[model samples]
Target chain A: NSKVIQTPRYLVKGQGQKAKMRCIPEKGHPVVFWYQQNKNNEFKFLINFQNQEVLQQIDMTEKRFSAECPSNSPCSLEIQSSEAGDSALYLCASSLSRHAETLYFGSGTRLTVL
Target chain B: GDSVTQTEGLVTLTEGLPVMLNCTYQSTYSPFLFWYVQHLNEAPKLLLKSFTDNKRPEHQGFHATLHKSSSSFHLQKSSAQLSDSALYYCALRYTGANTGKLTFGHGTILRVHP
Candidate 1:
């Protein structure tokens, strides 16, 4: 089975707290992507990484969120100051390449800010 | 700017009925369309994808045809099973970029009743 592993399936944080989620892509995948799904089930693209380099990122993701895919480590998305609006499901996906490829997604980390 | 549009938010059908989920896209580049299916509490998996060869892609009884003229790649099934009840997303890949990011539509939830 093609599976992506995400840590902390559910997370709860205070308004000013920090939240971090990690994803281990499938065995041989080379690209990783982060997306946020809101309560309305609308998915917003956050950022993507090829190896350890940031390929593309949305404005909102660059401002409040930071992601890193260190060598041999799982990819991580961290929020410095979590807000109520940041409460959503954060999904991590991976693909073999950047073009004309299929993505395999993780179960996702559901974040709730109090 | 690139975006995908899924017309049906929810579709309820009896078992063994044909299913069609509408998908439309707007992009400046030669878009590569895809269909992903998400089961309950699971990650989204690739169902089918469209290339530039004007060939329709099909998998596990689901099919999608890309129409460059209409900018649509609607997902259809001859007969949907109860296991087919899930959320479906239509996605597009950016042409010029080397990033593996995908712009996705809102989503359509299919509920197959017995």
Candidate 2:
């Protein structure tokens, strides 16, 4: 079965602390995406990478959050400083390509900022 | 700016009844629409996708048709099942040359009762 794997299903961090979430894309997939889902179930796009190149990223991701998909390594999204508003479920998804593809998502990492 | 809009926040239906989830999008460039369903404690799974060819995409029992003129890809099912209870997300992929990010709408929660 095609599945995306995410590490640290849950994470807790104090305000101003840094937190990192990891994701392993499905085999043979080339695109990885990161999204943040708030309590209201509103999904906010963070960033997406095609192979090893950064394709597109939202302002929030480029400013406070950083994500990278290195060769043979799990994709990582790191928050430089945790804030109350940053507490949400971070989801990672992988697709065969940018277009004409279905994305396979991993069980999101729920982050809590104290 | 690209955005996805879902009409309903919650819909409760009896099993065997038909289900419809409305989705709309706004984008300057042509958009690729998609539907994703997430069960409790599980990651979101791709349900269907819309292409510019104007053909309806169907998977399992769910289907959606892309209307580029209206910018809608509403999901519909002939018969709702108890297993259909989940959070459904409507998404649109940006087709701009520089952006390949997906914009997701606030999800709709479906509750199918027996």
Candidate with the greatest TM-score versus the true structure: 1
DockQ, 0 to 1 scale, candidate 1: 0.73
In model 1, state the lDDT of residue A6: 95
lDDT of 2 by residue, B71-100 (tens): 888999999999999999999875445545
Report the error of model 1 at residue B53, Å: 1.9
List model 1 lDDT by residue over B1-114, tens digit each: 889999999999999999999999998888789999988888888899997788888899999889888999999999989999999999999655567679999999999999
Candidate number achieving the greatest lDDT relative to the actual structure: 1
Interface RMSD of 1: 1.6
| Model 2 docking tier (incorrect/acceptable/medium/high) | medium
Residue pairs with backbone atoms closer than 3 Å in model 1 (clashes):
none
lDDT score at residue B83, model 1, on the 0-100 scale: 97
| True contacts recovered per prediction | 0.79, 0.65
Chain A alone, TM-score per model: 0.97, 0.97
Cα displacement (Å) at residue A50, model 1: 1.0
* Candidate lDDT (C-alpha), each: 0.91, 0.89
